[model samples]
Target: MNGLTNVSRRSTQLLRRSLHTSAALRDAAPAGQTLRRTGLYDLHKENGATMVGFAGFDMPLKYEGSTPVESHHHVRKEAGLFDVGHMVQSMFRGPTAAQFLEHLTPSSLATGLKPYQSTLSVLLNPTGGIIDDTVITKHTESSFYVVTNAGRRDVDLPWFEQKLKEWNTTELAKKEGGVEMEVMEDWGLVALQGPKAAAHLQSLTSHDLTTIPFGRSAFISVSSSSSSSAADTHLLHVARGGYTGEDGFEISLPPSTTTLLTQLLLSSSPTVQLAGLAARDSLRLEAGMCLYGNDLDETTSPVEAGLSWVIGKERRSEGAGFVGESEILRQLKEGVERRRVGVVSEGAPARQGAKLVDLKTEEEIGTITSGIPSPTLGKNVAMGYINARTHEGLHRKGSEVGVVVRGKMRKGVVTPMPFVKPNYFRG
Candidate 1:
């Protein structure tokens, strides 16, 4: 069998084994409780999508006919559409909006980011623990757009409200107009990802996609020949960035226009398949992106997660006064006890909760948080944390290690991440 076929078969076996062995890996839908749905819920269902509960919403896990491996390969070779509207979209507006956001994140939003530019940032707690990861886009000096993970809604929303109220009452806000936070309810966010994503999306809009560049966004008008209301084209906020480590765009538009726009994109080319969560997971893993609840949490600090690059140089040099600055700066100077790293192993796939041990001594060092058989690489790839002090000399790439899989120690190695090269479009 070919690699895709072999991986697909192995994936089936792994799923069956996971369901029986791990409760955390089972369906998230609560018994007798209704799960929320996104704007594209019905569309997904009509297209033979298998829905499952994720982050309190019923989302597409995969389609009925194609395997996840096939979907993953399709995205790498061509293009795919994904429904990511479950993420929280919010607007921060006011004269001091940029300053207010800078206080919440370590990124230098006030000085480093120009209008239309975006940065990946983390919201830190008072103790330097990560509250949530977010993407903040600068629309103007007084206006900003931010998208945060849906799983962190309960923790993130209330925190934002409390902080906004406190900041508005401060003396700084009294001099400059106070900041206002507005959640964009029911907005539809879709990600068109793959190597050909730019060409596919460019065919539908008049705005030059090349001008947006990676980490930048623009408001553009989309026209489709399939639409009856061609004259009344819809305005879309298109950001040229995604989690798949591919050249793509995350298009946010009004909820009413979502279905029509999706259909138009699908019709644009046969390669534009609708991918689901299953493919999304593997693609992001290969891209070395961290999933919120899996690789990050309130107890995990950005410095330890190997995400210190997200901290702006200006912020580190001149102190931005962001939340958790003291603890984060201290960690930067002194270093952390444990750090996240990538692991590649042979034999059965190492699922979450698998323990990592010293290759020769068999001493437990850490636990795996995320793992999968990479469809592209056809190898068991995982990410976990290890004691930085204990594995100090052995932390470099190619160091031999062992992962406890099914109660047996399996051979593994410390490897550099982004197992597959990222294809982000810089221009």
Candidate 2:
């Protein structure tokens, strides 16, 4: 405990120095307009986090004593805790809840997923464009727990309200029951990510973490003797997966216990330091995960974004299904003009909006949606769309490409993602 305390104090003390400082990095909240906060906001300040505006919330961009690279590598090596309470958590319940979700997403949620299994799915617009990527956990056939990106709150909530109303007026709703959405507002969410995450969290719960595989969740009771975050016992939702492509859990607990729960997790081990958005972004990018605003949008389809796997093969085989089934089926039948792929560029790391050009023709093929110098690989890795259909073999793996950084073309190669192998524990 002494070591943890010393690390915390030194972290905050150096946070005052603002390593790799940004004008936006400050201790105080951003001015101009009111910003929302998670239940763990107080805990973040106590731990010496440098807060910044993100997804309409005052979130920690990074903590002291560790730069983005340092924190990124820390989570890769050991466990790190993250406050993700700003994400919109919600529940859908009714006799027709499963049917409603299947309509909203392309996943065969109602039929394919067994109880308590979670799938990474995408909400779609009418024309097969991605509305937002989401994780939907089917608690039961008639119930679900969902987590969507906080940045899409404005678009998602309204879409839900409109869709629910429309669905309720249908013959299906009259025959079965109208689905209802219960938004889990102000709920506390934290992700414990790393290869060691499970071992640390295992000490606090009697429920065997070994039985809980990746893409599954369980309601478990947690306790900490040195902490008073919750009562003597607390039942929380522990989803055994995370954004970092590592074995971890995204635990959702009551808002009141947010800070104490975080403290409790920190109390469990010395290495489980608090990480921030800076590390989260780079880690996810390295994991080959999509950022909603950067890699996905209202204009991009799952087929084009290389996320067709998110759509169950069974569903894709049935053409007359889903909201945008027609377009999605058409794309699957006839290929898309472009595909999202990985690129390892030379000279410099590609940035968002960086042009992807053909190696032979130097013609613009696509744009880099996300990129970073991978801490694990020590190489410039990126994800971008490639539209070199006419120049056959250009988008294929091992083919040379170019990522235009500044005005010069940096040689790159079409590579298989994730740049770093995911360490998800299957057993």
TM-scores of the candidates in the order shown: 0.95, 0.91
Tens-place lDDT per residue, model 2, 335-390, is 88888999998886677778998777788888887777666786778888888576
- How close to the true structure is residue 244 of candidate 2, measured as C-alpha lDDT? 95
Query: What is the C-alpha local distance difference test score of each model?
Result: 0.86, 0.84
Off by over 4 Å in 2: 1-32, 226-230, 317-319
Clashing pairs in 2: none
Q: Kindly report which residue stretches of model 1 are placed more than 4 angstroms away from their true locations once superposed.
A: 1-7, 12-33, 226-231, 317-319
What are the per-residue Cα lDDT tens digits for candidate 1 across 1-427? 5985775777855643432233222434457766778899989999999887777678887887877777888899999999998899999999999999989999878788999999999999999899999999999999999999877787899999999999999899999899999999988899999999988888887788989999999999888664759665878999999999999999996878888888888888887999988888888888888888778878899998999988888787536689999988889889998888899998988877899999888988888877888878878898888888867855668888899998999999988898889999996
Superposed on all Cα atoms, the candidates' RMSDs to the truth, in angstroms, are 2.3, 5.3
Best-matching candidate per lDDT: 1
- Give the C-alpha lDDT of model 1: 0.86
> Model 2 residue 381 lDDT?
86
